[model samples]
Target: MSSAPSIPSAPSTHPAPPAGWQATFSEAVRLQSENRWEQALTLLLPLAEQMPHEASVQNLTAVLLAQHGRLAEAVVLWQRLLAADPGNVALVANLGRACWMLERKQQALEYFSLAVQLQPQDPLALLNMGAIHQGEGRFEEALAWYERVFAVDPHHVQALFNSAQLHADAGRFTRAHELYRRVLAIDSKHVIAQAQLIFTQHYLEHPSPAQLSALARRLGAQCAAQSPVFSNWLVSFEPERPLRIGLLSADLHDHPVGYFIEGLLAHSAGKEVTWIAYANNEKRTALTERIAPAFSAWNEVFRWSDDQLAARIRSDRIDILLDLSGMGSGHRLGVLARRPAPVQVNWLGYFGTTGLPGVQAVIADPRCVPEPEEHWFSERVWRLPSTRYCFTPPKNAPEVAELPALRQGALTFGCFQTLAKINPRVIAAWARIAQRAPQARWRIRCGVKSSEEDRRSLAQRLVQAGIAADRFKVEAPLERQRYLASYGEIDVALDTFPYPGGTTSAEALWMGVPTLTLSTPGMLGRQGEQIMGAAGMAENWICFDEDAYVDRAVALAQRSAWLALAEQRRAMREQVAGSALFDNARFSRDWHELVRNIWRDACEQVISRSSQGISGPKP
Candidate 1:
């Protein structure tokens, strides 16, 4: 809803307005009704000056500025008024919110803390504090503040959704799903909650791929129904002009998606394709700096709503829009649902189908979406000549040490995975491995930092499954260099099923510790397969079932087989370093071909439709 400045009667102590004040205020109101916000503010500023002591006029103006998307201006105005009356709780809370919109977290926390000090039960203040903690990865503190908000306002939807997200990130899918459903029961149309429920399904040991697709498709249909798909694109049809492609994602900073696409963005920007970045993330890391110069245009669009971003893409005349974050954090699939471009492709960021019919295609490789598994996707599969991802080797990774088993005299294994991936089924499988190879020592690194209680609970579960505390060790998270160095202690890396490793699996191969992966029927299951295939370990490492997974784990530990892997470990790093997975130049050439082919396809379809006299978007 559009809003404008509103003026209410001041107290008796304020000076009475001049005789023409009534008529002038009415004129401003009329201007506001006509959507002339600037004219309305112009008329009201003079009236506000007539009573300097009454702060209401300036406050209203600040709100108007905020509503008009001038968050920094709103913060400045709020600060100026706050100097006069520092005790104003509403003004303090407003400053916190404005600062938050500007992505100034520490400043927002300072103001929100003051607001909470003044009004102990303020839900907004409490919620903002929780959000700051959540973003910083201080999970327990975030949940505590959220609990306070619930105590004050039990049905606070935002708090519920965020708290649920904390659970989901910590791998407590059951609790997260419960909270998502609770939010849904209150407001059934919440798009992200719907997406979150489906995201949790990716981790299930035996999830119904069809059911997951049906649910995601329902979400796609709902968003499409409400979106305004652009049909009147002003793009030229001439064969040889440079094509503008927009990459939309929030993970362009210190993440797996960052590592995968940064090289491509750099290598592809030089040629006929003009790669534009719509970075949906707010935080900028070292990786962001490395990749920023690669793009022809970089837009910090974390704050752009779907309508705002869609309009911007249309205005930029982007020929193709690529979704980089997929169903993961900070995805702008809602904008894709709007059909903002002539061709939108779902690629590197997500696995499987987005379920949005508006998305014309998904970038695939022979490994990810084999011909038999093509039914899993909703969009047409545009298979690439090489791997799905082009990896950028971590600069800090240590050289592979002599295979850990040779010195230890028994097989040693490690899995550095999130708690979300280490479910009961995985634990059971590991327990079976422990029974088969009694001398096999295993190490688990729990990256889940939500609470100490959860960590202890995981350790207890391992013991309950008959793995002695002496035979296994559980460790906390470490920094990148140290984390990579730890791989030297393990002869083999154990991969989780269904929701198998993506980045960790690739890293395992890079460190010469081949991961034993269980590939199931879905894209989530195929991540390990893709990484292994790209790293040239397809036949020896990838397993199709639990029996095969167990067999491989056992077989690979035998004296002769273990020695072969140990020998391979010495050369594994350079082998993968030279493969299609890490060849940026090769990946770029493939991408150039991809962009040209998809554009040609889009142009041919448009021309065919024109010949048929068909008009409007492709629906």
Candidate 2:
């Protein structure tokens, strides 16, 4: 009877449905579906208040908030919704994504793990976990997660592509190539996969001109058919306006890229170019501050959203956007894709193609991207006259005055590249060299901060090769200046195989330390050979099989006179200084010419469009 006591008759008008709440929510969902995140957020807030307990609505509201970048608020809402429906895999995944957007790595990992546990076959959760691991530099762990994603869903193109990148990073080019091929097989129009496959093929010393040409054709066809709108927004032409050249880099402080750019900055005094530095990497030091004054504006873009940073660049009307991070750590290729400036160029960072359609050109030397190899790149190759890349030694780098004398009793060999560069083959070769020169001590300087595990692993490798523990020395990471100074303690720097040192090799030469490198066919692997060739030490540039590389290293270590020649050491340093390696003026001139050419090409397109009364599609 009480139940039958008339469930109060539903209100006739329902109070006119609270002023556009449904309409607003529908509009919000429409905006969200269109990926117009900010507009969705603007409508979502009041709609969320009106439907607080609607699980789907709440979940979507949180996601919308996160998309608008209100991460903390989004997290709170997600937590509230998860509390009610704790087993909701989608909600958990969305929360995890928001956590990642906020850089709450551990929280993100936990939520994503929970989502995966709840739905073992969820590729999104697994993929997100892989991304988190990749961001943290745990590429192998990332690869495992990506493999799991692939196992659950073979059509997971992102997982396949990411696995390829992880394999490439680990120097497992064969596996990477297979993964890239899988991606291409799935979607022939997949530009990234196509570009990466071409790059990996070239990297593994398997150049395919046909593949490169096909890739170019695909890109050109897409550009033509879609009529992609390249931004024409120009920085005001101040004829006398000091060209505001913005250099965006994650390694602006004391990284190798920083070291190379320092020399250029040192030589840029009184130039018309006003440098704008965007330091995106951590570890700001006194050296970074010292370099800051050389720039007209120095910003830390990590604090800004992609749009905010893009807007800042547009507002500043940067004449040239020089990206020093080419698909490396903390690279801002996404921002570059927005076409932040009239001219964008990749220089001194990534050696290969960026595969970004927006990049106008890649700065390189004729030695690297020779005319015959022009088809290999998505962007035009701008060849520097002498060397596309240059090395700038620290101003206060100590002269190796008498340090060679200390090596009379024992020859110390050094390699300062990362442990990641020390592939199993590289270690094996080093072990062979160590065995040949019993009196020589092998010193490996890993660029990463020292860890007990790193030391133990390295020691195990050396011991496995039948070398005594006492024969090997592992030095901790050093400040840029201290690292340069540490080179003084070594007789010769042994370059790694299949992926040789770039900055480290140049640094060694600049510090009066000779580097002997074995040239590999891959462009990245032969960087040391190129640097040494430019430094006028091609005699020291050893191109041999693995066995011969070891033999050369041992021979160089055993010859005491060769190691102790003060005159020769001084001459090598002088040659490095005078050679194309340190000539900033020549680099600047080359850069200017390339920019002019790009401008001319762009201007011609604009002229053609104007004459035809044709406006290209918006990007």
Candidate 3:
């Protein structure tokens, strides 16, 4: 009776309440539009509960759940929506994205393919498909998808940029250059495209110091204007506390970035910094195991939803978040945008601006970010004294063999990089070198197995360059130890242009195979030049234009004695190993300084926030 008396009002039903469910839904939508996601969720949840049979409500709920980092719940809700409305392309696309976040790549691809089929002209669909293919290392397939996006929306910046990168990676300099130019045409101030163009031009023609400096100045100003300095942003910080530093990367395992990071971790072992690794890759390898112990905590973040990952980093009291996979495959730039850390830096893995607003600094060396050209980064340039990155060969690495002894009379010119690096222009240059030095036989080894498709593509390219497939020796993927040993068979390793081999060049040098590099303008394109300089092989660093690159290749190939001095170079390898190329201690000191600076700045920000009685947002 008391309960009945308390519930006696029940009067709103007669007045139909102040507003209907639709009005309440609209209010919730407005809250969502204002980015008050929690408020929106609170209001929508009740409405959704009342309208469980409504597909639109369910879809909206799913989206809200996704935004709130309730990915599993969102996925279930999305599945229910899709079951009710299987023909919804938007739902399919969203579901695909969720699946991708969940690391259910196959399911994501199937959904994406269906969405693409349904919305053939949809740029987003094409981009998503392209991304999936790119992640799978099916560059050609990714290129096709990106091309379709470009065909539909010619000014699609991402598609244009990514396609250009794909072309550059594939060694299609002409195509890559054209696409980069197209991007610039659309937005001349596009710093990345401008840098890439300069890089491409440098690959085509090694610019002199005057040219490099001029380009560097222009790039510096552009970068400075674009760089994100935290001073201008309204940043809130939590109280001073034990700082956690999270590093986000797709290359946490046996990649160039991994090689560079080894020394830094070992040096930081006793430091106050708490290092956390957020690996965004699915393929776990021995290198992963090797690197895991270096971190205070290692997380495979590829499976976490972006929001969830961001929340986790925030919860860890991370002060500085370093993005190592800047725009590279499996990058979490979206999460970075959420401002998971008080300060974020882009370093090591990417040389160019991330074009993201959240990153605070980009770690560079004086050589990479020369004083006059410090303006090209979107983040403030944090210059390391020696080098921004340092390479270290695995312990117990094999000894380099003399090429003269191994090659017999046939000179073997090798390029042990991904096939994608062997662009048409590179193939042509190598062919010209081969034509010049008839005794030289080319040996190409890519990390990818010599699949029939790869063989046909490469063979077609070589054939077009007037080189017979029979004259070329192609090898399949090799293990790290065996891969290093394979370089012993080479007289010299030919470095790629526009996107020169970084770790590959260092590894080649470690194996006593001198690498010949063509220095380009951008840091990304001239990495080989940098590595060679660091390795004390500046003479071997071929600073040449395209024509000169071929000429140099021919000249180096003709110097059979120098090329044959594998034993002498082996002595040099020891020197190179002792040099900055593999000097982990020196590199570690540089890294420590750079990170300490970042951490100090973050700590100051925390202090400032606390003084102002504005506690920093929880991670």
Q: Write the per-residue lDDT of candidate 3 for residues 1-619, one digit (tens) a residue.
A: 0110011111122222234788888888898776667788898898776776666667788888887667878877777666656667887888888888778888888888888777889998899999888767688889899989988987898899888877776556788889988998888777667666655444453334345445535655555454332232233343334556789998887777888787777767655667888888766667678778878888876656656677778777677888887645567655776667778888887766665556778887755666666555556788777667877676677876766534467667888877766666677788888788877777788755344567567877787888877778776778778888887777877888666887888788777877888766656765777788778777745665878778777776664556446555658677887888788888877676677777667667557766788854321
Per lDDT, the best of the predicted structures is 1
What RMSD, rounded to one decimal, does every model reach? 5.3, 7.8, 9.4
Candidate maximizing TM-score: 1
TM-score head-to-head 1 vs 2, winner: 1
TM-score of 1: 0.88
Report every candidate's CA lDDT. Answer: 0.81, 0.71, 0.72
Candidate 1 vs candidate 2: which has greater lDDT? 1
The reply for model 1, stretches above 4 Å from the true place, is: 1-76, 83-87, 97-110, 448-451, 617-619
| Residue-by-residue lDDT tens digits, candidate 2, 1-619 | 0110111122233222356566777787898776566677777777777666766667778877665557788788878777767778887887777777677777778888887777888898899889888877777678899989989998899999898887776556788889888998898766566656655554443344445456544654453344333365655433344577889999877677877777677667666677888777646866687778888888877645555677678788687788987646677655776777767788887766565677777777756566766666677787766676777666788876544635467677888976656767777777787777887787788866434456567678778877788988876788767877888778778887666788888878888887888876434655777787777777745665777788777777665556344566767677778888877666556666565565556556556666788874112
Better of 1 and 3 by lDDT: 1
Whichever of 1 and 3 has more TM-score, that candidate is 1
Question: What TM-score, over all chains together, does every model reach?
Answer: 0.88, 0.72, 0.69
* Candidate 2, lDDT over the whole model: 0.71
Q: List the residue pairs that clash in candidate 2.
A: none
Residue 72 lDDT (model 3): 79
In candidate 3, list every pair of residues with a backbone clash: 171-423, 220-375, 223-375, 223-376, 224-375, 227-378, 228-378, 237-616, 238-616, 314-619
